[model samples]
Target: MLFIKTFTRSICTGKYSFAAEKSLLAALRKKTGYTFANCKKALEMHDNDLNRAELWLKSQAQALGWSKATKLEGRHTAQGLIGVAVNQYSGVMVEVNCETDFVARNKEFQSMVEDATKCCLRYIESQQKPQENVAKFSLDTEQLKGLHSENDGKSLADKLALMIGTVGENATLKQGLGLKTCEGIHLVGYAHPAGHVENGLQLGKLGGLLAYRSLGEGNDHIEIAKGICQHIVGMRPTKIGNNDDKPAPNKDEETCLIHQEYLLDDSVTVKELLEQNQLEIVDFKRLECGEIVSSIGKQPLEFVETCQ
Candidate 1:
């Protein structure tokens, strides 16, 4: 497992408190059945295994009633090293990862993953409404720092070292996805058994999440939500309108949730069917690769300089 000495040093220097470290060590040893002394020694020997060790620690914590198990795996082989996982607590799900598979499965590594996720879920819940009504949301700095507060005991790469040492592999948590619920409106979600799988242009990149206020029966909600989920995952739509003039790239396409043609049925837009059925759409969220895009509208620094 390849670990970044500098990154690990910084995390341990500020975040790893004695209490947290002790808890993590206990959980790691318990889960992997490795002696605490041996686990600590392994971490001391490697720098890249910090995040991996953290995840193993998280897994152990879950076993001890500290958290719940979610999907954890090693990824990004072409790059350096990375791992990813989903953890559930209360009603929240947090995606976590490390750089290597070896560390990801270790007890100490899993503990860190669980702890970090808990901190993130708690922070998000306290600050933001569960409803996705807000247009913008981000993590707070204080809470971010709090998650790393237990980092003081090990070398810069102690966590990563522990991960690598335990798993004998390199890794780190790269990114995550989260959702919450609130009154009035309900949120519906589903994911591929594993994380995401890369495919050509359509089915492979889509995941579904739908949120709307329902005045109908419980079974109705499930049926409707299932239909919508299928539509989203199965159909790939650039825009949801009949008019080519109103392509998804246009501004107007965003305003009418119903009018957007159903990805599953090009014959009618979501708007058209809702009106026909006398249904109302409070809001909806659809995530697709090459669809809901991130507009980082900027040229490279070199390009700007040359043009100037």
Candidate 2:
């Protein structure tokens, strides 16, 4: 009778182990999105604790994605969207890059860029010092990468890596700039392809921010700000100038903001339009995707990835 009891106990233990193994595999698969073999190995490594296994898989995935992203370093990323986040007090613009326009249009890619822009904006706001302008805040690639997103606590670099993994191409958070307005100053932004929305903020392949002080008494300055923003979107200006200054010899007209013809009335220059509207352009920022190569001193070969 003792021997029969021992055999029955052994059988029950074996059945329970098999059932637990099966359940763990299913849970790991659901959570990690890993293959059955990978999931089973992770469960075995963590002694079949579902939570531990999931965590291990996430870490592994992140490491792998980072490795993949590193391999894509130095690749040209000309195609991407410009993301903008703004409020009454401040506004931010960010350029995120990918290998192709198709990926640029991906909703996931677009969402990440938008989130990154908001993250940059929040970081700038947090760093604001008394009597200092927040508009002075700007981040390069590495600085922008270090910022944490409000949507998830993960750093922007981590988000970019995950996106690189998902899209099977390199991605980058190339540049970011923020602008702030004081009591007398007003900030306005424009994004081309105006239909794109990210986190309820407008986004496009090109974005511009204009900060100006209203010299006029009425709120028509608001309309004037919008008009300047629209002109910026169309003109793609690189620098703002006053009408009194002589044009820089050999300067690209397309890059000079005040030199460009006003979109509202092509007959007038942007500088003339500003003066007539009683607006003075205090500061402005324009972002176009993939404009960083000039600063970095290396022009990468632009290539599109195609499946073999």
Candidate 3:
């Protein structure tokens, strides 16, 4: 009788343990989006506590995702979007790159770029110095990675890693430029035809940022600022003024803002139009997708084939 009782208890205990583990595995898989094997391993590693297991799995996944992302780092990211965000006091531009145009057109990719740009703009707005003239802010890739998204509060690098894992492509926040207005200045941004309009601002493959200090009254300068932005989009000028000493003769007409013929009326130069409106160009920035070459040299054909 004693032996039978002990055997029954042993059987029941084993069944209970198995049932609990099965339940934990299912729950972990659902929460972490991990495979069955991965969930089981995580559960075992963390003593079957659901919260701990989830955290462990997440950390492991991030580590693995980052590893994959590193491998993709050297891949050429020629297709992407330029995003611009503007508010009453500040503006920001960002370039986010991916491996293909198909991904570039994806709404998720577009939303990420838009959010990143807006976040950058908000950061600049928060750091505004009212007493300064033309406060400028810039973020390199690593700094951009640390910025938290306003939408979900996720660090940009974490969001980027998830995107890389989901899309199976190399994506990078290539550049960021921020501008804040001082006293009489205002900021304007433009996106080319390939751009999309949101909140009355344009975002696309090519972007322009212009800072103008108004000298006239009652929103007239606003129109002038926008007109200059349009001209920038059309002309794709490289510099604000003819500051280049030995300017390339052939490229100067198209590359210098003051020298390019006005888009609205080709009869007048941009310099003359600004003078007519009594507005002065404080500063400007232009960013085109994939304009910067990758520092990583192209992989040899043999290496590419081996990976394939």
Candidate 4:
């Protein structure tokens, strides 16, 4: 048996290549590797080994496939970053970003992101409904085809690609979602006031809705619900609280205290709302794409440890 190798350079990404065959001076097969340097050395040592050269190429391709998979989902890894958040109730919220504010604010691009978020939410919600076999629910790829239209005629991802093509920078969804629970919990959702992805990234610009038990309640429930909205926007608590952790506030003027403040009045906390109306806050959620102000079982204003 003899060893033979050949070397070449790719026009794209400036990577290296190698070729090998049985003959010292005959046509040979090609092999590619991570770097041109490695290919050159391998070619020199194995000048006539076609089988070994092909194996090396396959090994390199497998190694690159792992990195490609992460990007395929448009997730931002530590090196390549993107931001997304999701919870039990509201579904997945993704933040698709570009380099400049000009591109970030692009109407076409923003529409695609919004539509995609809706698709993801709709997909997850559909998955959790009462079913005999829970495993049947998976994202219908066909829905993704519509994304190219960006709610027009293109698919959402295609629209994103158009944005990338127009903007001259890499643009992809940085976030995704999988909810932990959906029952016994209602989710209030917020989009940034601007209806823009970056707006979700900013503070005090979020718009959210409360998904409470659509069952019987009183006018106080409405008022309390409004208060919760305010709390979501103002205090931005991470989770609803039990009574033992902190004393309910005396007055409602404070916007942060959920238990002591009435929805209609900043002066009263949620406690006041409950006492007056005979109600309780089962739980609540606040949606902020970037900075988390508080977490469940925590203080007035604290940052969330992780979006995950």
TM-score, one value per model = 0.43, 0.73, 0.70, 0.46
Instruction: Give the better candidate number (3 or 4) by TM-score.
Output: 3
Clashing pairs in 3: none
Our model 4 lands, by Cα RMSD against the true structure, at: 15.5
lDDT of 1 by residue, 75-129 (tens): 3422221112111211222233444445444566555544444444454455445
Q: What TM-score, to 2 decimals, does candidate 3 have?
A: 0.70
Error of 4 at 5 (Å): 73
lDDT of the candidates, in the order given: 0.41, 0.77, 0.76, 0.43
lDDT of 4 at 157: 52
RMSD of each: 16.5, 8.2, 9.7, 15.5
| Candidate 2 residue-wise lDDT, 1-308, digit = tens | 99999999999999999998998899789876788988988889999889998888888878888889989888878898888877766778888988999999888798788888888778756654324222445677888888887765999989899778777788888887777655667788888877457454777877888877778898878877878987887777767765565765654455678877788888887878878888878777777766654543232211121110
Off by over 4 Å in 3: 1-67, 242-254, 293-308
**Per-residue C-alpha lDDT of model 4 across residues 196-248, encoded as one tens digit per residue:** 24423221224444444424554436545555655565555555556555653
Worst 10 residues of 3 by lDDT: 299-308
Can you give the lDDT of residue 135 in candidate 1? 20
The TM-score that candidate 4 achieves is: 0.46
Model 4, global lDDT: 0.43
Model 1 lDDT on a 0 to 1 scale:
0.41
The count of residue-pair clashes in candidate 1 stands at: 62
